[model samples]
Target: MILDVQGKAAYAYTGGKPFDASLPSTVFIHGAEHDHSVWALQTRYFAHHGFGVLAVDLPGHCRSAGPALRTVAAMADW
Candidate 1:
C-alpha cells in the first residue's frame, strides 16, 4: 500500500491482506540496508491471525520515496 506520510509516498506491505483500520495494528520497521521483506514471515503471521500488519520500507529505501532522513530525530519525526 502507499501512504502519504509527510507529503512523501511511503510504501507498506500489508501482509498479503487488504488493510483494515479497525483491526489491531502491528508496524514493522526495517533497519538500514533492508526493506519490508525482512518482516515477511512475521507480518504474514500477524496479519493472518487477527492483526493488521504494516511492514514499511522507510524513506529512500526500496519502494518508499525520499531524500533519506539524515538524523535520528528526523527519522523519528517521519
Candidate 2:
C-alpha cells in the first residue's frame, strides 16, 4: 500500500492484505539500501495470523518517494 506522508508517497508491503490500522501493527524497517521485500516471509506470517504488517520501503528507496533520509534520526522522524 501507499501512504501520503509529509506530502510524499511512502510505500509499504501489506503481506497480500489491505492494511488495517485498527489492528495490531508491526512496522518493519530495513537496513541501509534495503526495502520492504526484506521482510517478506515475516510480514506475510504476521498478516495472515491477525497482525497488521507494515513492511516499509524508506523514502527514496524502491517504491517510496521523496529524498532519502540522511541520518538515523531523520529516518526515525519520517
| Local distance difference test, each candidate | 0.91, 0.91
Regions more than 4 Å wrong, model 1: none
lDDT per residue (tens digit) for residues 16-78 in model 2: 888898999999999778999999999999999999999989999999998888899999888
- Root-mean-square deviation of each candidate, in angstroms? 1.0, 1.0
C-alpha root-mean-square deviation, candidate 2:
1.0
Clashes of each: 0, 0
lDDT of 1 by residue, 1-73 (tens): 9999989999999999998999999999987778999999999999999998899988998999987777778
- Candidate 2, residue 36: Cα displacement in angstroms equals 0.4
Q: After superposition, how far is residue 59 of candidate 1 from its true place, in Å?
A: 0.6
TM-score per candidate? 0.92, 0.92
